[model samples]
Structures are given as C-alpha cells and as structure tokens.
Target: MNRRNLLLCATALAGSFAAAPLALAQDAPIRLVVPYAPGGPIDATARALAERVRESLGVVVIDNKPGAGGNIGADVVAKAAPDGLTIGISATATHAVNPWLYSRMPYDAAKDFVGITQMVRVPNVVVVNAARAEQLNIHSLADLIAYAKANPAKLNYGSGGNGSAGHLAGEMFKQRAGIYALHIPYRGASPAQLALLAGEVDFNIDNLAAAAPNIRAGKLKALAVTSLEPSPMLPGVPALSSLYKGFSVDTWWGLVAPHGTPKAVVAKLNKAFTDALKTPETKTRFAALLAEPVPTTPEQFDAFMASERAKYQQVVRASGAKVD
Candidate 1:
C-alpha cells in the first residue's frame, strides 16, 4: 500500500478505538437504586425524576432495594462500579444520620458515594389522630408538651422506624420540650401512621407530604412542622422552632453515585437532574408532596452533605439513638 494510504488507515483505526467506549457508554442503561420500598415518598420521587431523566438519558431503571433501615439498598449502590451508570437515591436518614445511628455501617456515608445533587426537602409534621387530639385536648405542640409534663410516659409517640427521621425528630422534641413520652417505633411510616389512627399511639412526627392530606381531611391534626419556617401546605400550623429555638428536622432526598466515579460522568448526571428539576411538571409534582425542588451543583451538594452529616451526628448523640 502507498505510504499516505497506510497513514490514513492507521489514523482511522485509532479513532474508532477511542470512540468505541464512548458509544457503548452512551448506550448503557443507568440504574437508579431506591433504598426503600415502593409507594413511599422517596420511591414516588424517584419514579417522577426517572421519567424526566429518561428524556435526557435514553434508558434508566429504578431498582428498589428495601431493608435494614435502607442500608441494604444504599450499600448495594455504594459497592457498585463507579462508572456513573449506577446511582442511588438516598434520604437524610440514610446518608446524614445513619453513620451516627448505626453501631457498624457496611459503608461510609461520605467515602462510599459521590453526591450528584440534592433533589428536594420535605418538612416533618407533628400530627395526632383527630379523635385522640380532641380527647387529650392536645390541639397544639404546647398542649402536647404540657400534657407530657403532667403525665410522663403516658403519651406514646410512634415513628417510621428506629433511628428514622421521625424517631429522631420526636427525640429532638422531647429534648427541647423537657417531656418524657413513650416512643413506639414501627417498621415504616405507613404502619406508624396506622398505629396512631388506631389509637395505639398518641402522636407522630411524619413527613408533611404524607400527613398533610390526612390533616386536611380531619383524620389527623397537625400540631406543628419541624422546620424553621411554616410549610406552604400547612400555613396555619406553627414551626417547632417558634417554640424552641433552632428546632428543625426536615428530611432531604438526593442522588449520589458510587465513589470514584469519573468527574465528567458525575457532572453529566448532575446536569440531567438539575435540568429535570427545572421542568414545570417536576416542580409541580414535588410541590404536591410539600417537597421543594432544589437543584444544586455537585460541589455544593458535597458541602451540604458534610454540614448535614455533622448536624445529624449531634442529634444522634443527643438522642442516644443507635441501631446494632
């Protein structure tokens, strides 16, 4: 062959080798792991985002890995290949609080994953069964605190599970109010809410989105929101911070990839998520759940995670909430 032809042939082969991996990577399906069971707020949020994400990236799958207080699903994603294709949707309880709450975690919250972006934040609402609230005359947080002080260990509160956001919020309330109420931990929020409705428990600190409808229907009476500011969904309800300074416990959800993922891939995923949050449909959906869509850069998200971890660590220590 002529020298010129040989050079062109060699150049073409090199280009193909370089482009092959990029093509394959683009075609691969991205797996988004939800570390909780289906039908919950996190799962619903994941599914909503996934639909929009698919528009940006062709194929995406949401795999539910529920167990062990979300450790099982989180660990699976944490240990997966850091090729950007495998990501996990995690909550404040899993990423921020788990390290301090669990005796021995299978994975390190900071070291095991890279934060892509924060999705949303939902306030935790303090609610009680309407009938029970009327009987106890616990129309507000002040009423509950007064009652608890008067009758120690008589008021029983339920939570999603041990070491969950609801449980921690209740503990924080106890600490701030200086009351002694019995804690009843259930498998998840649904069961705990059920327990409260069945008159098995006095009250619960649950996600505002989950409790808002019940509150509006008069099934549950919202006493207060665990946020510094009042929730739009419950405008009449007061914030816990109003009664006790700095009292707040809002649950947040975010997306993270396995540690060591390429920076370019993380940036791409962040862009997709940020773009998804910008869509009117997504914003409306998140709003419906009393969740605010918060699109942030990866570096910003990392810093936020660090701060949240520190905050929750203190709460865990204060509450002495731990799981073996």
Candidate 2:
C-alpha cells in the first residue's frame, strides 16, 4: 500500500479499537444501589427510573444495602470504582443529614460522590391518629400547637429513627412552634407509622405517600403539610409554613456516582436519568407516590445538596441527635 494509504488505515484501526470499550461499557449493566431497604419510596422510585432509562442506558440493576442510616450503602457507592457502573441513591440523609448526625461517617457526603440528577421530592404531612385528634380536641395546626403548648410534653411523635427525616422535621416543628413533644423512634417509617395508627404516638410528621391512604381512610387526620405551600395531594391541609415562619421539611433523593467519575460519564448518566424523570410516565408514577419529580443539572443538584447540608447542620445540632 502507498505510505499515505497505510497511515490512514492505521489511524482508522486505532479509532475502532478506541470505540470498542465505549460500546462495551454501554452494554454492561449498571448497578444502581438503593441506600435503603427494598420496599420503600426510595427503592420504588429508583426502580422506576431504572426501567425508564433502560432503552438509553441499558440494564440498570438495583442493589439494596440498608443499614446504619444509609451510610453502609452510600459508602459502597463512595468506595466503588468511579467507572460510572456503580451509581447509587443519594437522599437527604445520605448526602445532607448523616454527616452531622453520625459520630463517624463512612464517606464524606460532599466529597465522595457526584450528583447526577435529583429524582423526586415527597412532602411530609403532620398527621394525628383520627381518634387521638378527636379526643384531644385537635382539629387543626393551631389547635395542635395550642394543645402542645398548654400541655407540654403531653403529646408525643413517632419517627422512623432518631436521625431520620421524620425526626428532624418533628424537632424543627417543635422549635418553630415553641412547644415540646416527646419523640419516639421506631425501626423504620413503617413501624413508626404503625405506632401512630395504633395510637401509640399522638402524632407523626410522616411521608405523604405513606400517610395518604390512612388520611383518606379517616384513620389519620392530616393537620398540616410540611411544604412552603399547600400540596395538591392534600388539598385542604394547610402548609405548616403558614403557621410557622419557616417550617418546611420533606423527603428527596437522587442518583449519584462515586467521586472522581469522569465528567463525561456523569453528564451521560445525568442526561439519561433526567430525560426519564421528565417523561409523562415518571410524572404519573411519582404523582401516585405523592412525589414531585425534580430534574436538575449536576451543578444545580450539588448546590441543592450543599444548601441542604447547611440547613440540616443546624437542625441536627439543635436536636442533639447522634448515632454511635
């Protein structure tokens, strides 16, 4: 072959070799880890996004690693090779609250991960057992606040755990309203909710999705929603912000990869997941779960997480909650 032709041939061959690994990477299954157990809103949302991104990103498998307030699973992601194959869930706890709440952290919340896209946000509702509310003459947020003020520590609230979102929200509520309520921490949100249903606790600032059924069934009286504005899911329920100047606490989670993942890979994953999050299917499914899809760029998600961490640092310190 001529020298020019030989040179072109060699270049083309090298180009094909370079493209082979990229193609193989696309075909490989991604391990999308959930930092919680299998059967919760976080898991469910992760699964939904996985299915939606399949056509673009290939098979995405879920790995549930639940323990130590999500640090165990998150640390798996943090310690995983940053090849984009081992992305995991990042929630308020994993990325924001856990750093301050835990005495020892498995991973640095801000340093160990790269944000892909924020998935969804589920507002919390302050709910009382229907019978308990009736017996206590608590019909609204004002009434509930008054009762708590008049009878200090007479009312009690149940949360998933000491440092879970529910517990932090309850603590913030108490601080804002200038009232005290005994906190009862259960194993998980389900158990805490069960405690509320059985009247074992007077009230709970619970996930709207989990509490919606009982609220509709007239078993739980939703006094207020923990959002800046009233949630459409709970139309009649006023926002706690209306009563307290700054009472907004809710559940949110998203996708993340180990820090040091290439910017190109992070962008690719972000585009795939954010596109899926914007779809009508995702919206409908999230609405059924009482969540709102929040698709944001990596920079935006990072900023959001930073603000959250700063906000929760104070909350956690004020609550004096810590895990050994």
Candidate 3:
C-alpha cells in the first residue's frame, strides 16, 4: 500500500476508536430509579423529567424500587456502576432524615450518591379538620397554640408513621413552638390525614398536594405552611417559618448518580435536568402537583443536602423516631 493510504487508514481506525465511547453513551438508556411507588408525586415528577430530558439524554427510563422508606431504591443507585447510566431520586426521607431515623441503612446517604440537581420541593401544610377546629374554637395557629397550652396533653397530631417526614415536622414544630402535643402515628399519610378529617386527631402536618382538596372543600383548615415561604398553591396561608424563625421541613427530591461518577458526566446530567426544570411546561405541570421546581448546580445541591442532613439529624434525634 502507498504510505499516504496507510496513514489515512490508520487515522480512520483511531477516529473510530475515539468515537466508540461516545456512541455507546448516547445509545445506552439512563435508568432513573425512583425510590418510591409509582403514581405518587415523586414518580410523576420523575416521569415528567424523563420525558423532557429524553431529547438531551436519549431514552431515560423510570425504575421504581420503593421500600424501606426509600432505602431499598436508593441502595440500587448506590450500588450501580458509576458510568452515569444509573441515576436515582434522592428525597428528604432517603437522603437526609432516614440516615438518622433508621438503625440500619443500606448505604450512606451523604456518600453513596453525587447530586446532579435538585428537582422540586413539596411543602407540608399544618391543617385541622374545620369542624373540629370550630368545636375547639381554634381559628389560627396562635389559637391552636393557646389551646394546647391551656389544655396540656390534650392536643394531638397525626402522621404517616413514627419516622415519616410528617412526624418529624410535627416534632420539630412542637419543639420549636414550645408546645406539648401528643403525636398519633398511623399506617400512612392518607390514613393519618383521614384521622384528622374524622376528628380522631386534632391536627396534622400533611403534604400540601394531599391536603389541598380537603382545604379547598373547607374540610381541613390550613393553619400554616412548613416551607420558608407561603406556597402559591395555598394562598393567604402563612409560613411556619415566619412565626418560628428558620423552621422549615418539606418534601424535596433531586437527581443523583453513583458517588464515583465522573465530574463531566455529573455536569452533563445537571445541565440536562436543570434545563428541563426551567421550562414553562415543567413549571406548570409541577405547580399542578403543588411542587415548586428548584434547579441548582451540583455543588449547590450537595451543600443543600448536607445542610438538610445536619438539620434532620438534630430533628430526628430530638423526636426519638427510629426504625429497625
């Protein structure tokens, strides 16, 4: 063969080799592991993002591994290869509070995953059954507090369970507000909210999305929000933080990959997801679900999760909430 032809062939072979990895990455579908059951807000949001990011990341798939308070699904991502093919949803329960609440964890919440970006925040509303509130003559949070103080150990709140976010928020509220209200644990958030609706429990810090209908129907009177600011979904309702400075506890979930994933891959994932989050379509859809989209850089997400872990560590311990 001529020297020039030989050089051309060699260069082509090298180019193909260089292109192999990129081709494989582009073709391989990213499996988004949602640490919750299908059909909930988390799963719904994951599906929405999956649809939007498909153009950028190729075909992204949703894998629900819900169990063990999200530890089971999170562990799947924790143990996956760090080649950026497997991404998981990290939430307040999975990443922040569960580490302290559970005696045994499948993986380190802070170390097993690298944040890509924070996706959304779902505020919890402090609500009372309207009939029960009227019966008790409690019209506002202050009125409830006064009632609690006047009738110590009489006021009780319901939660999904002992270690659930609702439980922790209630505990933190009790501690921060300096009130003593018994906590009534139920099977799930639905049941807990039902207890409140039926007047079995005096009040509940319920997920806004779940409580919105009741609140709108005047069955549940929203006293305040657990978010730092009043949620747009609940107009006129004050934020608990406004009353108790810096008090904030709400459901938040973000995208994350295996801990050792390359920085370049992480940045790429962050950009794709954050871009999708900024779209008007995503914002409107998330608003319908009563979730506020919060897009942040990977470093910012890491910092946010770290702060959440620290804060929940204190809150979890204070509540004496634990799981085996």
Candidate 4:
C-alpha cells in the first residue's frame, strides 16, 4: 500500500479508538442525575440535553433523587463510582448556595465532584401578578422598593422553599433596597408561582425560564432580571444591577462527575454536552425555558463554581437562611 494510504488508515483507526469511550457511554447508559425533582428547570434541561447528548454520550438516563434542597441527590452522585458513568446535573443550589444555606451538608460541593461543563444559565427575574402590579402601582424595582418600604409586612414575596435562589434573591433585594417584605417559602417554584397567580403573594423573584411563560401570558409582570446585564429573552426588562449597582443573581446549571473519574472520560463527557449545547435544536428548546446555553471548559467551570459559592456564602449568611 502507498504510504499515504497507510497513514490515512492509521488516522482513521486512531479517530475511532478515541471515540470508543463515547460508544461505551452509550452502551453503559450514563446515569444523568438531576439533583432536583423531575419537572423543574434542572430536570427539564437534563432531559433535553440527554436527547442531544445521546448522539455522543449514548443513552443517557435521568435519575431524580430530590431532597435536602438538592443535597441528597448530589451526595448520591458524589459517592458513586468514579467511572464517569454517574454524572450529576448540578446547579447554583447544589454546588454554591447549599454549602452556605444548609446547616449540615451531605457532601462537599467543591471537593466531591469534578466540574465538567456548565450547561445553561437561567436568569432570575422579579415578577408581580399583573393585577397586583396595577393595584400597588409597582412598575419598576424602584417603585416596588418604595411601596415595600411604605407598607412593610403588608407585601409578601414567595420562594421555592428556604435556601433556594428565589429566597436568597428576595433577601438580597431586601438588603440592597433597604425595604421590608414578608418572605413566604413554598415547597417548590410551581407553588410559589401559583401563590403569586392566586394573589396569595404579591410577588416573587423566580427563574425567567419558569416565569417567562406566565409573564408573556400576562399572568405576571416582569420588573427586572437579576443579572448584571439585560437578557435578550426578556427584552426591555431592566437588570437589577441597573437599579442596585453591583447587584446580580443568576441560577446556572452544570455537569459534574464523581471526583477521581478519569480525565479522558471527563474530556469526552464535556465534549459531548458542550457539542450538544451548540446545536440549534437545543438552543430552541432551552429558549422555551428562558435559559441561555453556557458552555465552559472544566477548569473554567471549576473557577466559576468557586466564585459562585463565595458570592452566595455571604448572601446566605446575611439572609440567615437556614435549612436545618
């Protein structure tokens, strides 16, 4: 055979060998653990990602084991075999906020897992029931603050249980705005959103992906997003940072494997999901949730996780959010 032909065959073989693990991942079915219950944003993202990632990762299976505000499911992934098969979909709640909010954590956020790739970032937004907004004349963050200050304890904000991002954002808003409002915690975002729709609560700071439908349907009115900059999904909506300089809060989700997983496996998994994130289909599906696909390298994701935990530690401490 010609030298060129020989080299071509060798190159093809090497490429196939490199992709062997991806094929193995499919055959073995990578256990994609969503630390929260099914039907939530994280779970939905996992399911969507699984369909596309399967083209690379093989048949991915979502396993939901929600408890202790994501700690229970996270711990399960942390202790799983370091074989890269048991990867978890972690969020700000599991990796960043829980360490500071919960009195006793089931697993160490930074130490127990290896960062894979950040999947998506869901902007948190402050929404008031449309009727309540008109009744209180709260059209903007500033207006809400003024009304809240004027009527302390009369207005209430709901959250997806204590220590959730919604709760922390509310507390941070209170601290930054220097306003007082009662906090009512619910079992989950659905209930909190329902409470707002039912007029049980005046407002809520919730994930835009979850609240965007309601806002578009006119069931709720979005005042601002809890991000440093504006979100395209919520056009014309002011960023909370615009109102409270330096104020920013966004809930992000990522993939993580049990620590000690082979670096090659980590690299394969990262490529699979990051590649999935680039697809137009995934982008369209994620848009439905009002989430933006954010793909990052393992090292970058690790650094990002550190910054998130550090930022939320103070918020949780200041809010005095306890999940004991």
Model 1, position 120, has a per-residue lDDT of: 95
lDDT of 4 at 104: 78
Candidate 3 off by > 4 Å: 1-23
lDDT of 3 by residue, 220-292 (tens): 9999999998887888899999889988888899999999887777878898999999999999999999999
Candidate 2 on 155-192: residue-level lDDT in tens?
89999998888999999998888999999999889999
- List pairs with backbone clashes in candidate 1: none
Model 3 global lDDT (CA atoms, 0 to 1): 0.92
lDDT of each: 0.87, 0.91, 0.92, 0.89
Q: Model 4: how far is 224 from its true place, Å?
A: 0.5
Considering only N, C-alpha and C atoms within 3 Å, which residue pairs clash in candidate 2? Answer: none
Q: Give the TM-score of each candidate.
A: 0.90, 0.92, 0.93, 0.89
Residues 1-324, candidate 1, lDDT per residue (tens digit)?
999999999999998765543343357888899999898878998899989988677687899999888899999989998777789987797889989988899999989989999999899999999999899888888998999989887988999887888898988899889898888999888899999889999999999888878888899999999988988778789999999998879989899989987777787889888999989999899887778998999888888888889999988898887788
**Which has the greatest lDDT?**
3
Candidate 4 lDDT tens digits, 85-110: 79998889899998988777878998
Tell me the lDDT of model 1 at 253.
Answer: 87
Candidate 1 vs candidate 3: the lDDT winner is 3
Give me the runs in candidate 4 sitting further than 4 Å from their true place.
Answer: 1-27
lDDT, candidate 3, residue 78?
Answer: 99
Instruction: Give, for candidate 3, the lowest lDDT window spanning 10 residues.
Output: 17-26
Error of 3 at 148 (Å): 0.3
Given candidate 1, what's the lDDT at residue 4?
A: 100
